[model samples]
Target: MTDIETRIEQIAQVIGQFDDAQVPRNIRTSSKEAVEQWLLNKNKEMDLRLGMTASIMDEIFNDSNLPIHFGPMCLQVQTVLETLLNEVRGS
Candidate 1:
């Protein structure tokens, strides 16, 4: 299995590809606005999924008394995503 850092960065890089590739080509200018709105909504949904995942991880951490290092590794993935979302929203 890949280590946490490598796997997270690999996922992030794939998401970057999706950001560029997910949209339909030959969209009308008026419809392009709608597509952009859909992308933003999808991004928000991704954020929510990440939040829920982290919450579940937090529950496990609390119940098991896992290493402090372990909690941050998972949380750091979410933090990286939050930064990406902020940048997408800002743009």
Candidate 2:
């Protein structure tokens, strides 16, 4: 797969880890939607998908009920998405 597609799959895997029952239901549900609805939506442009995913990750990072540990994970995912976005835009 291409670099962009590989990064997306990695992001999806990281999000999948948060799907555990340990996390709040809302966070889990939102993460799932971010992956399934936005990240994996081939109809949308890659840049658009990355932007939307980053937005969702930002929301998750700010969630009151989010575990402290998840904050860094969210940031990492957002950073990767942003980097990919920059590359996509610069090309």
Candidate 3:
């Protein structure tokens, strides 16, 4: 897979591992925005770095106070990325 494709998949996998109830409200919202921005820009290096940072932050901090729909938003972003990857591969 290409670099863009790899980053997309990596972000998707990271997002998939998140537990909605454990994520902070701000992080949830920002994660969705980050995914959307990554989708639009597809800056492989930057996107990969952002995804890795988010994953690290989430692992270090697990907040359950504020509720957010981060899981669903992530799944949506993942689906879009997967679709785009498939299209790029002509599959």
**Candidate numbers sorted by lDDT from highest down:** 2, 3, 1
What TM-score does prediction 1 earn?
Answer: 0.34
Model 2 Cα lDDT, one tens digit per residue, 1-91:
8988988899899988889877899999999999999998999998989899899999999999999988898899999989989999999
Order of candidates by TM-score, top first?
2, 3, 1
Structure candidate 1, residue pairs in collision: none
lDDT of each: 0.40, 0.91, 0.52
- Top candidate on lDDT is 2
lDDT of 3 by residue, 1-91 (tens): 7776576666656654553657665666655555565433455554354444445335334444434555455445545554554565563
* Alpha-carbon TM-score of each model against the true structure: 0.34, 0.95, 0.37
Q: List per-candidate RMSD values in Å.
A: 14.9, 0.8, 8.6
| Residue 13 error, candidate 3, Å | 2.4
Provide the lDDT at 88 for model 2.
94
Candidate 2 lDDT score at position 29: 92
- State how far residue 79 of model 2 sits from its true place (Å): 0.5
Prediction 2 TM-score vs. true: 0.95
Candidate 3 runs further than 4 Å off: 1-4, 43-91
Q: Which candidate tops TM-score?
A: 2
Per-prediction backbone clash count: 0, 0, 0
